[model samples]
Target: MAEALLTLAGVHTHIGQYHILQGVDLEVREGELTALLGRNGAGKTTTLRTIMGLWKASQGRLRFEGRDIAALATPEIARAGVAYVPESMAVFSDLTVRENLVLGARQGRLDSARLEWILGFLPALGKFWNHQAGNLSGGQKQMLAIARAIVEPRRLLLVDEPTKGLAPAIVQSLLAAFRELKATGTTILLVEQNVSFVKRLGDRVAVMDDGRIVHAGPMPDFAADRALQMRLLGLAMEAHT
Candidate 1:
């Protein structure tokens, strides 16, 4: 088995008055995609936020490359070779696509080769290279968000529902981009409800319910077992696009 690039052990999170995560544990192996699957309010987004230090983990540990990051700030986490793409597609609405990519490059400059590499798979970004992100369509903005995350090399990428509300055609484009990233050995922890997207891309799977992982293992095994899907997700994997 490949070594883990990121791990969360007994992680818990609280939001002012409520506990959002309770004893959550997850592992994202180097050079593979791990699908974090669950129904709404299962703390999938909270798990990503906790890992990125967007939300403090009230308990437990988060480690990246064997270093504790539960206490690290969000910018420090990014500096540590981790990038996050929220489900909201939080692009800089006021900035041009070029400026957004420049900001994403932590070293203060974009690598021409890497930019070309990203564009190779995500051509839409190149098409709207100078357009303000706010003016782009939903799918285009999603592409820009992903492009920004990969503008520089990263040890791990935490993405939330990249395909949500996207047209099937756009989803296919994202599927291709992720495939290229996988080929480059990028480790990814993806939180997604679109089982069809992950079914083709995920190497491992973890299902969360009630803020805890209730089932986890190889993606093929989980996807093949319809009963397991129904029991854990309360819906069929085939039911999602």
Candidate 2:
């Protein structure tokens, strides 16, 4: 309802000849955390890839900030203010944390004010500023990846599996950071399998299955709808409980 920051209409994507995305449509409102939820191989990652222009859509259009970016290159799209953090936590293994943060500053100008803002949300990153990303633990690497994305003046962030393979305590910390980031007016589109994480951070949720979004609604509504969750995500609340 708020001006759509990102929109995809009838998006179709293919990797080689394997048609992965088939007519997917999604809208991300400005300044909200929109979660893309699905079981494994539901094309959640591919949707993020398509939006970031890593996997060019074979058909359909992707508009960001009221501009058509379906044909732009990945770097061009990133320059347009969309940052992506892949599941791998794509941090520079060879670079020190400070050096990685420096590279993440989009304008090539580091603002102490912005740095302070990010550090406030991720105190662990502040402590590890001098450490190499490769040496950091899984949760630390995830934090660094997200901090790198936020260091820039970004309009939208596409994050894939930010809580993958981390301890529950670390996940809670990351979720708190996400809440802080959302409060700072950052628009986030996240792909996550963790239902609890989705329930906590998502203002809206979209369930992807077989390369398509099959269900979407407010997070509470989705969480309460046990049948939908069981059907789409193959998860039962009772089982998890």
Question: Local error of candidate 1 at 192, Å?
Answer: 0.6
Model 2, position 178: C-alpha lDDT score? 94
Off by over 4 Å in 1: none
lDDT of each: 0.93, 0.90
Over the stretch 48-143, how does candidate 2's per-residue lDDT look in tens digits? 999999889999989999899999999999999999999999999999899899999867787899889888878888898888889999999999
* Superposed model 2: Cα runs more than 4 Å off: 237-241
Instruction: Please give the TM-score that candidate 1 achieves against the real structure.
Output: 0.98
TM-score on alpha carbons, each prediction:
0.98, 0.96
RMSD of each: 0.9, 1.3
Which tens-of-lDDT digit does each residue in 1-241 have in candidate 1? 9999998999999999989899998989999999999999999999999998999999998999999999999999999999999999999999999999999987899999999999999998899999999999999999999999999999999999999999999999999999999999999999998998999999999999989999879999998899999999888778874
